[model samples]
Target chain A: MEQSSCTVVDAQETFSRAREQTLIESVKGGDTLAYHELYDAHVKRVYALCYRLTGDKALAEDATQEVFIQLWRKISNFTGQSRFSTWLHSVAANVTVSYMRKQRGWFQRMFSIDESEAQYHAAPADAHSIDLEALIVRLPERARMVFVLHAIEGYRHEDIASMLGMAVGSSKAQFHRARQLLKAWMGYDED
Target chain B: MTKTNFDDALKQQLDTLPEEKHPERDLWRGVALALENEADTSTAKPGWRSGWAAMAASVALIAMVSWYSLQQPSGPTEPSAITGEALVQALSQQHEQQKQALLVEYTDTPALADNWQQQLDELDDAAAAIKAALAEDPDNPALLRMLQNVYQQQITLIERVHAPKWQRI
Candidate 1:
């Protein structure tokens, strides 16, 4: 008899187990190569996060590298208390936001009164092509990061709170604010 | 434009992102090499023990290099400023120190060691470009600092990998 196809649940389980195990061993064997493999697997996703956070490709690229560079410099502290991906996103969010603060004028460049009004109506189809990715770039720094982690990347408000050094409710509120902004920009009603 | 309507539209958009964008494998290999160099030294552990040690080493390394650069007094005056991007890129090269722990954290697959020596050479080229840029504008403190950092990081990585007793593997 033919074997049944692997279910989504099974695949997820297999992948997670494999990933977790790989990390555990690499850490044990003193394999820096393993450390980078993990970084490589996730750099683009992290870059997408930074790009959305900064809305400037060059700045985002810097922030993206900083996130991994920080991770590489600090991965020895990754206690398996929480999921590795969760911790990684937390670092990505914080680093991007901090870098954005230093950048000084990103908000106005992307969302000034004139640009918002202009982009609102004729938002291109390609706008949503990188849905979570593109929607993120349009968000203000804090809200963009909150929404990226909670709504898109799927972290809980509590986890976001801890990672970002904010209150849990605030994390929830920011996520909502981000969604509202995205809706408004994308031609959605506030309610 | 309604809330529900927006959610539908946004959901549809979110679902459309391409599953993957194949990285320039060649470039990624270089990045991988750097990460390996960062993680190469140190014992692996569950949490911050190893990380803290690495951070301490990095800070010390940076400080030492900065001190050494300053001590040269005759090297260059009016250190040029570098773009923030270049500063971060320079820091990104110590891949040797952090790769091993990452391997343990993600254990199943073997970590691939790429052509790190080639990446180091690429870094020299990049550093030369940055230095040339700084030469044109020597008054920029930021660029000057970055040039110093890049120069030091490249020298250190080269020294570490090419040390008399060490092999690339």
Candidate 2:
């Protein structure tokens, strides 16, 4: 029974992967249904990537939608040189990075009002659910991206390097730095 | 802690993090419907737009190619524009001459008519094969390049034959 269950699970995963490949090929051939299918499959992962990068829900949501919009515009250029997930991640990474770079000038203005805004959105003090995720929000941009990819998404340094256009060594260094920072923030030294 | 231990710890932490969920399918469906409803009739939908754009782009690309071709000096109203058949004939002529040149190198005397006749017969067979291949794909750039290279080599061989060898001073 266990062996049969394992095979069933493996088959399901394989079927889904093949389905995604078909959807990508169809999208390249200009099929709208394929677009919808691809969008549905990836929107959350895209949103999570954006959210982790930006640490702002609204910005993440907008970036996620814009990423899909750009994907629709550029899907024809995708000649399947890389896995579809890798290509999509690269697009999202680039879009988020560009958006963050452009928004840096607004940081000073936002900093002034950040405290009041934080208080307004703050959940109850004893809330375990919110505080854990809230700790992630405080992480620096590069660290957050490293943590999201290396930690949350199970991507290797080499994969992250190709997706983010960083050197593999730099990706490892960033992952190390992100881990150290997160450990510090969470007060793990006492443990 | 050792590097391996640190990595193991990090992996555990990452795996333990909560998976994020987005708004429900119905909400996304509603958004999709709204976007579709607002679609500009002036600009056709995405798939059709890409197809139309691809066709337009191909035409423009071909036009650019023709424009560049025009920039090169075309001989004025010449009856001898380079065509596929002309090119095959040129290659046949070339292969024959090259075979003769190679044969002459062995024979010491350059003008052995019997050797030259055998080379010409081989060239005729080669030219027939080339003509058939070129007929299948006349516009293939790779074949065109190969044909051009053969023509240039033949010209050089002809020049070599015509040149006078130097006398000792």
Candidate 3:
């Protein structure tokens, strides 16, 4: 009975994937309803992704809008070599990271952590979410970015290295550094 | 396709990080308006593919600059394992890759100048000379600047040939 239930759940997931794939095809054809459906399904997740990367609600909101707009413009490039959500997440990450970079000053490009550490801490406190998300926002810029991309998004260090233009070792080091910093701040062992 | 499962202290809390975090305001309205705005631009200015050409040019330019900066920096530089030779090889490989892609893309596009290929060949020779000079004096700022100039010229050549400027009437 347990095995059969697992099989049924797997079947349901497969069905959902197929349905979403078909909807993506419709979206490729510039179907407005299909686009809306895709947005309805993916917006919150995309927004969350943007928020985690930017650590700013306003910036995340802007990045979310930009992601969808970019999706509409570049949907024709979706070659189906990867899953739609995977491709969409890639787009969202690229958009968010680039947006964050642009919003930085010339000095921030030279230094990973900005003076905004105080500002990031100054944001409103969320009572219910004192876990990873809160600590994530508290991380310095580079560590936060590496942590989000590696830990939260499950990107391999190799891919993160390429996207962020660093070596694979540095990417791994950043992830380690991020975990240690988070653990220190949270006063616990996460590793 | 990220596996959100964690196996540490925050495992339970991490599990609670929902896949979706709804925005405070409805954003579809802005998206719809943007779609309409883009639609207007498309119809108003036909064949905006040049915009992509422009963007590609910018990306390639940035990549070249980034490659240079990564080579000549201390903090946040490329991995320690990548030596100066590897840096040169990487930059050359990146240049060749982008150059080939540009050639393929602009194969049928009308050239702005009949002598553009000759100009590119000359720039390539200059870049080669600069590389040879840098090989002798790796830390020469003048040589590095010249190398970057050569690269910038190559990208400018590609962009000009593929996405020529519009002349005002």
Which structure among the candidates has the greatest lDDT? Answer: 3
lDDT of 1 by residue, B33-90 (tens): 5555565543443222343234334544554465456555465554335444554444
Q: Each model's TM-score, in the order given?
A: 0.48, 0.48, 0.56
Instruction: Report clash pairs, candidate 3.
Output: none
Which consecutive 10 residues in model 1 chain A have the weakest lDDT in total? A110-119
Q: Write down the lDDT that model 2 would get.
A: 0.57
Candidate 3: what is its chain A TM-score? Answer: 0.80
- Model 2, position A124: C-alpha lDDT score: 32
Candidate 2, residues B45-144, lDDT tens digits: the string is 4443343334334433553464456446665532336656665566567766775776466455443122223333333343344456577655444445
Off by over 4 Å in 1: A1-3, A7-16, A27-29, A81-83, A101-132, A155-177, A189-191, B15-169
Q: Give the TM-score of candidate 1.
A: 0.48
User: Model 1, range A92-119, lDDT digits (tens) per residue?
Assistant: 8877766665565655543454343322
> Which model scores highest in TM-score?
3
Best by DockQ: 3
Residue lDDT tens for model 2, A112-183: 433223322333333222244565666655556666777776688898777656689988887776666555
Residue B79 alpha-carbon offset, candidate 3, angstroms: 79
Categorize the docking of model 3: incorrect
List the DockQ of the predictions in order: 0.12, 0.11, 0.17
- TM-score, structure 2 vs. true: 0.48
